[model samples]
Target: MKPVENAEGIQASLTLSYIQATVLKAKATLTVGILNGAPINIGIVGQADVVSDGKEGSAGLVHTDLLMQYDIQNDQFDAFLKATVKVIIAEAKVPIWLYFGANTPIPIGETAAEQKTRQSQNSNFDYYLYVGCPDGNGASRLGDAFSKVKVTIWKMDAGIVSGSLYGEAYFCIGSILPKFPPLPDEINKFLGYSTQSSNENSVINMINQGGSASGFMFGALVHGNINVDLAVIRAYAKATVGFDVALLHVTNPGSCQVGTSFGMNNWYAVGQVFAYFAMGVDLHIDVGLFSGNVTLAKLQVGAAIKAGLPNPTWMNGRIKIVGEALGGMVHVNKSMKFEIGEVCVPEMDPLASIKLIAEVGPGTDNVSVFAKPYVIFNLPMDNKPFKFNVMDKEGHETTRTFRFKVDHYTVKSEDNGYVGQGTKQFSADGYTMTLWSDEAFREKMKYTITIHCKAEELINNNWQKPAGKSEEEESIAFTTGIAPDTISERHVVISYPINGQNYFLKNEFKGKKSMVVVDQRNDKYFKLENDSNPIKKLTIIEADGGQVINTNFSVNGNDILFDLPGSLKNSTTYRMYFSIESSKTQEIKTTTELVDLEKTAGTGTVSMADVDFSTVSINTSVNILGASGSGNAIQSPTTTSASERGIRNKAKQEQSHRDAIDRFRKGETPVMTVINEGIENGTVDPTKIQDGTTAQGKEVAVYQPATGRIIYQMILEPVNLTPSPIKWLPLEVS
Candidate 1:
């Protein structure tokens, strides 16, 4: 039959005899046509090894072998293949069309219309059209022919357009075709093409050689094509610039295998790339335009470009003392020093030498000294020590004992006394002193020190006794002096006199003293006497009889009942003494000695009776004549003498009364006695006077009263006088 024409100038035709012989591989059996085009042949290949027999001469055909053979499959493969084939055919130069008819027997020359009618009456008939092509090329040609055909076919029948061919023809074709090998040079280019390329094997091999070289080459190639489809060289240059700008250019690059697929494997490599170059390159390539599906080669190229950039380092230097002086007192007399060992700088070049300038004081007079500040070149290096000079304010260079040493790059300055004596002396009463060494030595050695003053002499050679006295006496004149001593050297001596003997006093008072006295007195007290008053009072006095009598004194009382005298006669030396004496009594008359009367009890005692008087009254008259001759014989009592005697008698009587009252108050009995011509007598009354009553309107002495109550009283008078009315009477009851 003649082929039909489609809009694209493609044709479609079918023969029943060709369908049976080619698809079924059977001898000519039946021929019939139910439509204007050939029927499609859908075959399922269940195994990868299955080969399609070209005898299936159907114009519209699809195979499902590839999908069925794979352990895992997805609809993507199916869809991709279907769309590819449909597009290829739709774009061809010829138009082709086919159809199926009922399974009715007909001769090979039968027309399409006649076949269709014959198959209409038989519902059980299944028909297929043979387009006379077994190979893909021939089938493709047939499809090209249909492209020009103009039959009104339903859009639903366009299986290729809808992607249903993915499960049938596309997958089947993939299963039959041989997989391409990888190529290193054209990997990225090959992947760029829509159709599979010949260099696949070479590309995969390059990916497997994961390293800087492969990463750079592959990544550059891939990155360029995807980037803007720019030239590979241009893309590489752009990426490198970006890496530099970003400061991410890696000095070293590395690569690794990330993953693999059915026909393609993925590789991953990373390295720092310059942000500037990468950015520029990416912009040129319009990388953002691409979807997320980028090849590993592109990423590796970007990373490698980043690896070739450089970063700069910053550094500075400085110096300072690590440790301070122990006491913080820098003295000139001792070794004043510090260490250069603590000097340090950061980010310094290991191979470079450090330069340090050390100044001790004013630049004008001071000297600058230093040793080569170079560290040793060793595998593991240490700080280097260099000795520098220390200058004084006056610019004088002082001597030092210790020095600094650097060995094996290890720097250290030891405590060398050479900087100075390391010892200082200060007058006990002087100001703080300072001493230091030359600046040169100081820079080399470091030291901390405690300052101390030398002890002053407690007794210097100039100490001497005052002159004029014997050595023994003069020795007492020596005194103590102040001095500071090293804790180990404290000692002192004191000299003074004791009694007549001279003694050297030793370290007695170590600290400050108010005064020192030396006394030679045997006794501390003495008696004072008037040569003319042998019977007078004696007095006690303090002795002023020593060379050391610098102290003062005074008398405690004027009355001298007894005397205690201090040593007298300073040069001769007399001892202290004491004296005692008594006063004389008056004469008494004879007959008044014996008398018995009621006695009164004293103030302090209890009384039993009223008046069994022991009160005495005795009168005795005697004539007073001049020693030469009696100037006048006494006749009657003259008022003059009488008055005198009365006064005297009154005084006497009052005294006696007071005495008696005192005795009674003290709980003692009052006694009345009269002694005459060498005879002493008194009267005692056992049961007598009453307790005394205090007299009113009578003057009584207001002396400090004794403890207890008054109990008795007594009265005495001369026999010649009349008794006055009793001003005070005693109670009679016991």
Candidate 2:
């Protein structure tokens, strides 16, 4: 052994020699102080052997020792340095005391030379090895000294220990011994291994002192591929005025080689050191720390699925068009090539792609344990009701089965029904799917939808099951939202003239018939009908103060037909009213506007207007029959004188004309017939029957009004009418 002094203090080095094949274990204890003064005994163990480093053939002897330093007060060892070594070799089965440095502490203020020579005279102990090892003589015995001792002692096992002790030592000043091994907390202060450095004042201070405290794992002591920055260790060593003591005080399991056994064996020591030193932390051998598929952090899969529209929708029929959204959390294990390998969560067939929502931490190339993934699918339509069943890889039913039904209606018949009563299996290959419904859908009156899901079905992009309970659940049901008070459409009067004359009231059916001139458009009367029909009690009213006229009426293919009343003034405007009763009552009415006579030649196609025409008397006469004509006046007496005969003849002619006009006022088509007969027989004067033309293809009469106009009214029943053209059907998008 040789002792040397440096800027900090003095340190010494020594070696313990043993027969390689015979030695099983070894330990050493040293007691040193100033000669002839109090001595301090400090215990330490030898953990490494040079014999393991291919040095076993040095004259059949192997040397072993540990490189270590102890901080001793300079005043404690003044001049004559005294030390002794008691070694126990497993093969020897005995203890040998090897005297080295002089014993006892020098009195304060004594020089090294003075103390050394003074102690040499009084102390009998010398730097020599004693023979004949004692049996448990303790550390106090000096044994027998000889000029040269060739003692062979048996070695002993250090024995496996449950806990470990670790610490550092400074070179001189025995009282300034290295602090008890820094637990992980204190280590974190220098290494910043347990948490973020930005928040740790100790770590920040370390960095500010021109050193980084990152890249260290405080969970365990590691060698070889150690997770530590050599530069940081150097910086810490400089600041603490001492080197780090990574040594583990554990039993040395034999066969440890510096070149080949650095990893596993050293790791064993590291684990024990942590298990013993890290307060309150339960430590164990973590196999994952050395695996290729280690999980740096976990963005666990969830057993819950969330919907974009979690609430019931008013547009249930349009759900397919609206699309549904679903998703969960996922982690990209960077160590496994940015994939969550099968060892953790395996990828399944259904997931299409993944989007890294965000990085779980600051490093982009590191594990993204907090990322998110989403799935969106637009529903498809079919001719039958929809049913979706969810299952697992084992073919067992996992999630509940979803169901949907679509009800439809036809405009003409107002018939309503639903399609599909059977079940259909769903596929798990994708997030998108086809939803069954009636392709005949035009307008949906009502509908409902059910969604199914199992705790296991709600997996991550990797199809990994969540770390939660795999509970099975029933379907979630959602129905259509509240319907509006009334249904409406764009319907204009499909009859004659112009829209100026076809302006109907909103929310109802009503309008004027003036511009609808006789024998003009549609051959005679103004008419109106809509998508909703089989309308009843269709009647016309003179809004400008005129009674309902008696007119011919009929219905032909959704059209309400009637005669242009002769009594209706040419410029006068009128309103019409009607109703439809089918589960609900719909009263239709018309609005009055001046007849655009100039536009009477144009086809009327205007935005339909309607008003809620209140319920009117349903018992009103549907048709008003014209009254019979008065009988012809009697002829004057034939026996009268010439003056009396002329008077009688004129009186009879006047009475005959009046009877014909009376019939015409009653809207009787026979009135014109009687007039023509009078003219042919010379009983009615030619000039009395002013010229008037009847509608070319009509059997009705158009007689000249010498004085007053006639009133005409009639009603058409739809029971005998032809089928309507408008057909209402339910429709679904996509």
Candidate 3:
């Protein structure tokens, strides 16, 4: 071995040699900087030998050193030295040490401190080896180096044995350094096999199964002729195996590849079995039939049935008249007359063509005849009531007023009895009778029966007694009196039984009969009876003078009768007197009567005697006395006959009487003097005097003739008196 210089360029010489196959130890010292500097030491191990350069005198004894250098900066030097030392010592070879006697070596033990100091010094110097051997192959020489040193071999077989090397010779060295044993034979079993062959076989099996192991069970079976590529097969196997591998890693179960290895031949079959298990479900399919046997065909059948029915002849359908036997026995010829209310069917299609038949019994002769079948139909009749009239062959001898009650007829079908109740009332004008029924009844055959009413029989059956009276009568009676002014042509003579006398009186008088005079002053009037002296006397003086004037007058012996006049004044006083002479007694009978009468009785009279003086009466003795300024005298002698004294007494005492009367007189004058000259002879007539007089523009003042009050009496009547032989006196006046 040689010492090298430090970084300061200092150099020193040192020698290292091995003497034999024993340990040769040497030490070299050097100072290094810093108190804690790393120390390094190196050892060289070799053998001592003889060497020649090919001359006889040149053969000499020499030593070869197996050097180890420690340079901390050079990993190659450190590794080579470490490895060489391990190999030499495993062989029990020798080694030489240098640099062992330093202060650093004493603190860390001589061998460990020397190695640290050399490592520090060699940081700048490189280490090298020198061999001195006599053989070209280095093994024997390497063996001698080991024999001289006392070190044993750390590991054997570190170098190549034989043949060309491949792969990891450095790792072999590392193995020997650690003395690790060889790998087991079980681990190396696949050491030299090819992986491509295994992958190719897997691809071939996948292809034989047609790329789908479950295809056969799915009915997609392929023959062995189907092929697949090895790469695809391998990829598929890897995906499957890797998936299971991942499962195992997470689950930490047994190896996943165990099933693959044991079941490789049956893999396709297993998949097929699983597929079949999935496919074992039930399935179904459906189909429908299309034969023409539905309801539409049945409808066509019904139409065909309708088509085969019989056809009608007239009016869109056949007409079969039907009639029903009513009250009378009816005789119907089988061929001529048909029954009403019978189900004739009217020759409709597909139905029977039979006509409704009807018959009458043996007693049905010479009467109204009708007949009907059991079933009646409104369909053939169109819901109209059936009507038929039976007549003789000549059509002249019809039944006497036989009326069919067609309103009571009904159309019935089959055994539905009656179609409905017949309409009770006939149509207006007594023509047709209609029956109402439901639509169901109209759809069937119907029979109708009509009742007949005989006019004569109805008249007899419904006869009634007559009623009695109509009204009542009434009578009335009324009465009224006749007016006094009515003429005598004919009068309404009122006859009433009074005081047991059946006195009849003519209300008026005519011709040879005396005029009926109503002497109202005497209340005596004449009434005519049925005898020759029908004129009777009535005394009704209770009437005014105006009511008595112009009244009809008549006379009878004693029974005086007259109607009271209506124009009598309401309040009046009247006096009446009658004078009559009795021939046998030679005496005058005189009497007076008074009446306080109202004016309503137009012809009332008071009677002095019982005789009616309605015809004639005497008013005698008019006396004239005095005037206001003249001494005119109209006086009569007291000794003369009461009837004849009018003129005699007037001449005898004329002047003296004038003087005597004028002394007692006042106002007004008398223009005339007259007397009843026939009063003494009993033959005075009142009608001889003027009926009425009017004053001729002269006012003769006199006292009131009725009231004795001074008044102007217009002396309208001029009177003259003749003197007589019985001592006449001068007329007195004033």
Candidate 4:
């Protein structure tokens, strides 16, 4: 391998086969070699360059014209490299060919000018090294003879056929970095390495320990972060290149996991903190022939993490179980029902972190109806489940009673809304509920949320059919009551005994009557067998004589004002009774009946139809104050006005009676007057007064129809009565 003067200031490819090379400061350390049947020490390969003065007449050459010849003084040889070769016959250590830069082929018997012309065009070569011989000589050639020796340069290309390119990715083991030192114990264990040289990872050890060993080959760089100017590249086949590329080597091996199952090898983030690569970038591969190249392929590694708890605000979530500490234990005291999938239960340790992992739909729409204040509730199938031990951070079980509260609530349905009057539609698909610890510092608290999914379709919908009974046990939702028609008249207003001692009365009619009210305001009801709000029972009694009427009457919404027949005597009271049939039951027995989907179209989600007449019937009375047949009408009390009926206040009237009695002794007894003037105003306090005293009186107001003016009111004579006790006998209870 000899080169003449033309090849100067040029870089060359140092082709080696079956070897490993490492990048070190923009240069390469070629390891492993076979030359002259002996391994060679590592040598440096520099980028093609030269040191020369550009002035002409220096060493009889200019920078552009040859640079130097073989002729040199002994002093000059000290500063400059020798361009001459000393080849002694039958001797070793004799200087042979002194070569530099790329090995330019000088054709056999070719003239210097012809070789120069070829070098200016395209002189092919593979590597350049000085071919040396020993200076110890058996015989030496004449200086002129050695100087006139011609050379034949055979190019190493045109003989190459096929080859491959390869790349290997590695990183620094735990304690030691990727360097020429003993590998770490962690890397040795991972690679099944035992002793120094008798291990499966010896190839890596050899490469690291023998860093300077020669004969190692390398590939051309396609893409890399190495600090070197990119080299000009060409395909080895030179056929047609750049189609669907079949890579023979890794392009970015640092970021890629190639042909390895390391991901499933139970690697934890323990010993190793960072990753580094021992990439064989720009490695040359061959199949006993030509060398092929590969780009810079990368390989990467990361842990497959087991996630934790989901966001607490999400409508649904799952509990992530890390280790199998609580093996096969099911502790589900709380539950969340999602709209999809099988009910999943997660078992975890008692003191695990309770963060939640939930996959929630983008935004949330809470559709929960609390039924009443303090009674928190939510819709079905709109929740996520998270599980954690109910133990304190110190490993003690905590039984703190916690309540779920509504952080957000609204009708999230896109399709439903209130229409007209009292009609609103529930147009949402479902609802949401976010349960949190009601305790202080609840944000720091963590509880295992167990998801309770309903297997029974009817149960999830709020109705549960009784075991033996055909009726279903239901849940009810009470709504805000509507406005009454008249101030004193409310059909849907009712009050009855709750705890047996005191009464729960409708506020509107609490003092107006004796536990009097019947809520018939809901003109609509569940499976109502009749017209709008039909009455199931009605009984009337003329209280003055205990005469009962036939069970027949018309019931309309809030018919609080009614009149008896005109034949009824003055001051006579009539008691009216109203009830539902159970043989006609009006009340909605169970709360669930209100929320059954089959019953309500999602709007009227509640029913209060159960009127339990088994305890006490609701009743009220009206008095026929004054009825005019056709004659003087016998001036009597009218239900129209309290002041006009002569039944002013029970206490005032009784005091007036006692005053009249005192005056009776002096012949000055006062008679009660039924005033006609106040009757037309209808300002009546209809409170009943049973005082056992009656004073006969008459009130007459003769009005002229043409002028519409009251003429006069005549107060007639008065008659007083006394109370008497009746004797009674008890019937036997048979």
Candidate 5:
């Protein structure tokens, strides 16, 4: 075979026909023959026989073994073959025109319709890479290359005679090179193509590149901290490309597995497989899916009963429990049928099954009342309302106020409980809670109180229903005594200023001027039987002069106190007159002595015998007969006329003096009489009471009745007397 002179390619097409009667056989083979040397056989072609009928020809089979040594680099055959095909038929050489060319369309025996239909199917030429050359060359290996062959069959043009056949073959070198162990970049790209390939590096890269892996794909991130297997990734890269090249060569050989399953796309599964290989442990991550059931592991409550005072400071109580741990459990199951985002609200109805119950006391047990009682609880979770059902004697009350305190952290509601009123809401450690009744119990009344809660509805603590009963209860019964009002005045008596005692006027008393005082003792209450102030008014009198000393009543009704004048004498004897309710004006006599530091040192130990003010008189001898010559003179008369009128005037003055002294001794002082008369006439102020006339209101003239002449006119101004400190000298009543 050879090329035609000036022809662009080899012979356009090749066709052969034989008209034999019954059996026609054909065979073709190629041998390279040197110019003057023996022919060298490179390949073989087996004979093909045809059995034809007298009417038409029948197709036959021809088997051939052939190899064309070619250099793809130069687009020509090897030097020994000289880019030609020498075919010898039946040992008698037969000339065959075969050419390798630039552009040529091989032809085959098929109609235009058949060719169009096949073309419409979009078929591709089958390719083959012979591992070992048919001429006994070695097989291919890694990084090795020969040539790639593409064989295609097509029909000739109808104008060129239909049903005529031709064959086409394509060749390229090094394009079919075999390279094993894919590069890391190629492996990364393959992994990035699928979300399931969540190797730590692959997942992070994908995520950084704005790709996502959801569901079980991200489970590894939470389960094992995003563990990945580099070896598995390497193997996957190699196996994937190897299989693809094998399929290109039309063969499929079993390969190694990527861990256990081919679904390496599941990150959790991949992590599990890697985990097993690294540590021999299979991981089962929760993946934020729960079975939607919680069990009650433990339940404990406070005492069933408690006794309290009429107005107890605090009532011990509790509603505590424990349950199964619900860690990392999501609201939905793995199947993802439904999703609940809102938490269940706790029950807050006061009359509901879960509440604190305060039963009614005596006299109206049949009625129901809702009182706003105060309560405390040790609920360490949410700060939600804790309801209570209060059944008082009457049917009218508000919901209870509850304060939940946990670990010293107090969550007070809009209204505070009794626990907030100076008492502890929670225990020292903030676990126990003490409740208090809103109001003091009625006197001598029977009452009962109970606390209850439903464990299942405790959503604040994430508590759910258990298999059995979930309601917890505690109760207590007690009867109250007489009301606090009555008890306040019982067992109390006045214990100050004994009937007959002597007291000293201490210098300190001048500052306070509060002489009469009620005793500060539990048994010395100053309240009247009707709970009113016992003291109506107080009156103090100079015992020697029988003159009343006005006093002021204490403003505080709970105490019996009196404010005396600030002008009291040190060595005077005084009498306290108390006008008390349901009693007479009681009188207590007390003699006062000047404050003696030594004698007063022992408080409440001063005796009347210690100071003798009555027997020691600084009068007669000292005033009338002493050497001082300050003698007592006769009382002066009202007036005088001539020389002898002096004696008569003196006699009248003495008579006037005698009459005045007599009247004063008989409980009628001249000033007192005048003041009383003026008071009766509504002309003088009754509040002013003084012996010496100064100026209280309008001046009145004094008349010398013995001489029938008007004397001097004067006014009176009262003076505040300092009180003497009265020390109680309790003595035997007998």
Candidate 6:
């Protein structure tokens, strides 16, 4: 071999000429340290062929040689170099005689010509490889011939190594020399085969920079009763680098075309290099979760039916709906949806499609070996993915697109089911994949996520076994939307009129009679009978400033009502409140209640199941308008005078008309009767009678200021009286 310089000009080389092919025996000519003497080159030149046996095939040059460089001042062949030409494996760490041969230090300032003359015309041992232009300019074996010189060597299975063995005087110069070589097949594979993709900063290369062989195997794993048919090996580097991967089939295992033998004997089926940036995701699957299917990530290996061969028939393919999230983790406990042939592997740059690798070790029920997959890195971005529509919770469906990251990432449910059991999965960061199946999808929302996966598993290995789900997880934060709306309707008193007056109290409810609001909008609010019921607030107050409300009120259909304890006072005012709420934004939150007042106050208390209140009351009295006739007065002067509070004499009655009014307003319908028993036959005067009905429906009393008399009355309705619209019939009036 010709001598070569490293990055630094330290140079060394060894030439071997093979004499026998069968045993790989050859003659090796070793040379070193020609740079030390400059024009006066100095080093060893063994003219005789050194017979070495290691000169071919894999372990080239299995031999060693010790060559020494001489320094006249140190005088005893101070520096030495030993080369172990090659080894069987790529790496070896045996100690060799790499330092100088002796610890002798020579004095500076000695030049080769000066040293030669100073040592007497003939020094012990001096040599020359070639004669230069003149006597002093020959390739001489004199270390001091030149200062600051370097020597380097190169060989197979090891890389370039350089350093120097140099010296100097007042001009103290240093030497550095490192030997260089053909790096092992394991080392410079990238420089040999790796390259950049079209995309910016993208690269494709092998992963086993420390391994001796090429090509990888993809296989499936089987558990007790399940066949883990899906798995993916991918390449992902730090940032922005993606891959355009392909499966190069090797008829025989070895480097593509390393040895000349490969070019002649090995057959390779080069596949299509797909779009880039695809990666493998860790989907944790297990048989314990019978509801969900397994994938290439973490899934329990199912038991196998067929154990041997290229791949077992037992490995099952699982169909799953995998989600593609941003670079961060996403919890997958969402509704499961599916679209065949859809793959969802989120990446820096997703691929246009995914392809699976072939089986290498075949599937085994009991995995005996650990998997060591080749993970390539620094790939480029890829082609356009298949786009389709996906539905959101808002009932809006939008189109999405995906690409292939791994060529062999196929997994389907038909082949990878859990004993025919199905499931809904819930996975979030910070949590393991838990399969939750609502055989009925009970509380789960029905949603579908589009999945894009490769047609097969992409790996080549002898072993595939189940991996437990990762407990190390991350949390996916979510903002809960508004709770499902549940509000039936709200009711308000639009206009409640009594005695020809209107009370438009929406939030306020005040009325003497039952308010029957007959409208088409009765049941406007949602009752949400299927959902949880919400609490409602109601407040009713009388003009006397007393609260009147009770839970005992009954709800008929959708109408809300509270039975009043007593009638509202004639001129008194009252207030009412109605409020209800369900969700944050779904309810009768704001309203108004206005009441028109007509009042005269007297307080009275009423009781109920949940409320107690005092209400206003009105009193009425009747008196004689004219003096009793003298003849009739003297004749009737037998009992008592009119000095008593009511009259000259009081007569008892079953119940007064005021009592009837109170009963009717208290959620009751009262009917009253009146009998005429005042002077029916003797001296009947028209002036002595009073009307029982008044302008406000009916009257309860009559008064005569001339005699300070009061005639009691019975509450009456229009229908109970004669045709004059609440006209009362009386015997006569004086």
* Per-model CA lDDT versus the true structure: 0.21, 0.25, 0.23, 0.24, 0.27, 0.25
Q: Compared with the true structure, what per-residue lDDT tens digits does model 5 show for residues 1-734?
A: 22111112111222233666344534445433321122212322233334534222333322222234332211223211101112221111111112221111112233567544543431211112332221112233222222212112222333323221122111111212122111123333322323332222221221112211222111110011122223212110011111111101101101111234222322211111111101111223333774232321212111111111111111221122222223323222111111122111111222222222222111122111111222333242133444444322222222443333222212122223222222324335333444332223333344444445443334445544533334544433333333221112111222122233332222222223232222122111223333243444455556565555544445342234454455556445665544333232232212223222122212222111111211111211222211121334333223332222323433443454454444434434333323323332223343443343323322223333333332222221233423432221111111
Q: For residue 368, give model 1's deviation from the true position in Å.
A: 18
lDDT of 6 by residue, 1-734 (tens): 11212111334555445465434433333333322233211245321223343434333343333344443223434332223333332222111112121111222344678655544422122221111111121121323232111112222221222212211111110111111111122222312222221111111111111111122221111111112223322212111111111122222222223445332233221111111112233343445635343223321111111111111011112122223333334423222222222111111111211111111110111111111111111121132234434232222334434322322211112223222122323222211122222121111111111112131112242222212111111111111112212121122212122212211112112232223121112221223233244434334555366544322233344234443434445333455433333533343322112222111111111111111222212222222111111111112223332222112212111123334334334423322222343323322233444444333334433333344333433332232433222222221123
Tens-digit lDDT string for candidate 2 (44-64): 434333324334332112343
lDDT of 3 by residue, 252-299 (tens): 101112333422333312111000000011112233753221111100
TM-score, one value per model:
0.11, 0.17, 0.11, 0.18, 0.17, 0.14
How far in Å is the alpha carbon of 489 misplaced in model 1? Answer: 28
**Ranking of predictions according to lDDT:** 5, 2, 6, 4, 3, 1
Cα shift from native, residue 297, model 4 (Å): 74
Model 2: how far residue 624 lies from native, Å: 36
**CA lDDT, candidate 6, residue 551:** 28
lDDT of 3 at 362: 10
Q: Name the lDDT of candidate 5.
A: 0.27
TM-score: model 4 vs. ground truth? 0.18
Q: Give the distance in Å from residue 432's predicted Cα in candidate 5 to where it truly belongs.
A: 5.6
**Best model per lDDT:** 5
Task: Give Cα distance to truth, residue 692, candidate 6, Å.
Answer: 41
lDDT of 6 at 632: 17
Better TM-score candidate (1, 4): 4
The per-candidate count of clashes, in order, stands at 119, 57, 110, 71, 19, 116
